[model samples]
Target: MTAADGSRLYGSDASTADQREALLSGEVPVAVYGLGKMGLPLAAVYADVTGDVVGADVDEGVVEAVNAGECHVESEPGLSELVERTVAAGAFEATADPRAAAERAAIHVVIVPTPITDEKEADLSALESVARDVGAELDTGDAVFVECTVPPRTCADLLEPMLAEEAGHDAFGLAFCPERTASGRALADIRGAYPKVVGGVDDESTRVAELVYGELTDNDVLAVGDATTAECVKVFEGLYRDVNIALANELATFADEIGVDVNEAIETANTQPFCDLHDPGPGVGGHCIPYYPYFVINGFETEAPLLRTAREVNDSMPAFTVNTLAREVRAEGGDLADATVAILGLTYRPGVEETRATPAGPIAEELAAAGAEVVAVDPLLDDADEFVAEMIPQRALYDPDRDLDAVVLVTPHEAFDDIEWERFDPLVVVDGRQYLDLSDTDHRVYTVGSGVTSAGRAESAEPHRDANLAAEVER
Candidate 1:
């Protein structure tokens, strides 16, 4: 078969249907490109299926780890053992060369990162680079599937033409299969939980792509209209999340002004069964939520007014957090210029080491830029001071003798839930994520979008007096 660009899309012997049947009968050669969080776990799944799985990555360390029967990315139970067994059986291997891997495999799954530029433009350099590499070595009948979050037209607009031009085919069998695997539970979700979305450049492409994914996942695969629609499905899923988070953030702010607890109200609202509301926090973070919408808006020239507004609201959260902390500092009779502020939580969210698009990084950088001596802490972060230089470990949040102007809780890590607020001699708490209980604390505590007052009798009288005066003046 050939693609529109006159390239041999797939070889006569490389049948996706045959591969699928072989996968069911336990005989398929699958190569997964990019060994980051998503690709590594996917490779492990194919490994478990006893299929010939080639894990390819540009990073030599990751490739070496996979070849040594070690999993580079953290995943669910039994992944290490599966990788080890697969390596021992010669069923799995890792390589840095894409062409070599492509030559040896009947199915290629591209899982490269599709991040956005500072101007909110889709940086398809990495994806394009991979496409060029794959195109140079693609054979007829070999199926190539893209499983990254991208704009609706990316696969058809960029990938199809690139592959066709590189391989000299008219219409190659190509498909877009967006992955819905959650970060932490990727191993389980990839194997069974989330259903797959498969869309092809044409009908034959769709069938072959479905066959490839069906072997690894037990969940149902829904075939969409075409590649563009499949691409939209991924972006829509993420944009939907961004919009809901913005709504929650906006409502949380309103709830604070009206003396209503947003969390409690959301709980009540969720009882209706149809109104499922996501919780608001310091802001939306992570790779997909923060970056994917920009691609959708930019790629399609679609007027996503609400989505655009939501992006603004979420992006502005860091500055808002810093401003809120500044107010708390002022309440303690201290200005940011001379105050030493301690920030709690550095990771974007809880329980993950991923810092991509993490709001805490920008928040800390902004605070430093505003002349505040910022000290950051996160339980998951070891050697935190070195990782970002401005951050410190949770245990070293404050020097006992040096009075802290404020402690900003940016991430709601469970460990922070039990902290004794009395430790800081003169502390003003800003709960950015609404994670802490300020009801019993003696320190004056303020939360993002929530007006929860603290009940604390401070040992230092002068600061408390100034704080009360500032509170009165602001009202």
Candidate 2:
């Protein structure tokens, strides 16, 4: 960009003072593409920080909902009210035309999903598609920020060239600022919590990204070496969790073998500062952990044997859970093929409605394939159309005369607490995530990660648990 253009736009002068004044005066307009779960909260935060913001998405329903001041996104705290207030104040608006929104806005942010293909390759199609639209409306010194979690080198090696080709101008600034927030606390994370990591294709792009985020977040903006490093930050975070959880799950398998309580050991071990372990469960789910490993596994030529092994360990959890279920059913003098099973919790996480890559789907499918009748229940999920299991509401789940051959606690939402678990007589129970205390129930229960068996609950090898109980009783 020429000196005159630098003086006119944020790319040229990304100083905090200049950007702050520009945002307040409505001179530097902001456009956020993708208005889904994370996108809407981010757009709302932008509106709260800046005076004017446009939210763009291909989904017409989302566009209409935002335009009508109704939050289509579900279960997000304070998001509906934030959207209503922002729309009411005219600081935020939703649009279907990305090109139009991009043209009018000086800061164009992309928060689209980067799903992995069936072959486990990173699917940048959505990100590429949005970049093309953003490029179409780009002008000299216009800033484009990618907030999608992507494989390293995607921002500098892929997006920069792609945007340039589409825009016919290499002058448009590009930055990679990975979205670090989860679905439940997106607004809070975006507003503060973790410091935002920003890296750009060039020095100018880096400066512009830092300036814009400095105004949007109350937290400090950490400028990394380049866009690839920023990409690495997000992917590494997910990768670490995936491997850590895999380790825990692997250890959980030893409970039955070693005849000891693994969770009790883990709980005691975690008291020390160095032993930071992820919880073991039916499986690791969600859009992030399960998919991010594939980013490295398939993106480049280098082999990720450890990552591949971790994926295998996590992927096997569903079947392992089913195996435990089958044993319990057989112990009760019945085969799994002839028994009825109830799979509880469909969402990957509790209190959130997101179902992307949730392990509950696989657990339900496996049970059905094993010839057992499966009924799935979750307070957050009313529709289990994606799976073969019969989806029932919480009320129907707790029928007084209900009897199932087996029950597998998959996601374990808090709503399950309302159910009188003692009301049902069961011979088989599989507690994923170790959410149940089988010692109190008559059924032969198997708690995942606790090393407990269907015959009896496992005992801890260490005296830490006993010490804690004694300490608490004395107090």
TM-score for each candidate, following the candidate numbering = 0.87, 0.91
> Which 10-residue window of candidate 1 scores lowest in summed lDDT?
1-10
Q: Per-residue lDDT of 1-475 in model 2, one digit per residue for the tens? A: 0112222353454666765677666677789999989999999989878768899999999999999999998888899999999999888999999988887777899999899988889999988888888888788878899998999999878888888999897887888998889888888899878999999888888988887788778899999999889999989999999999999988887776676788888999999999998778899888899999999999999999999999988998888788767765665678999987887888899989877788887787778778887777778766445442342222234454667778889887888877676777755788997787666767777788774454353432222124442343123
Candidate 1 ranges beyond 4 A from true positions: 1-19, 24-27, 75-77, 384-387, 390-402, 456-475
lDDT of 1 by residue, 67-170 (tens): 99998766346667878887888778999987788766666789999889878889988888888888887776667899988777888888898999998984
Candidate of highest TM-score: 2
TM-score of 2: 0.91
User: What's the C-alpha lDDT at position 98 in model 2?
Assistant: 90
Candidate 2 ranges with C-alpha deviation above 4 Å? 1-15, 383-398, 453-475
RMSD of each: 5.3, 6.9
State model 1's lDDT: 0.74
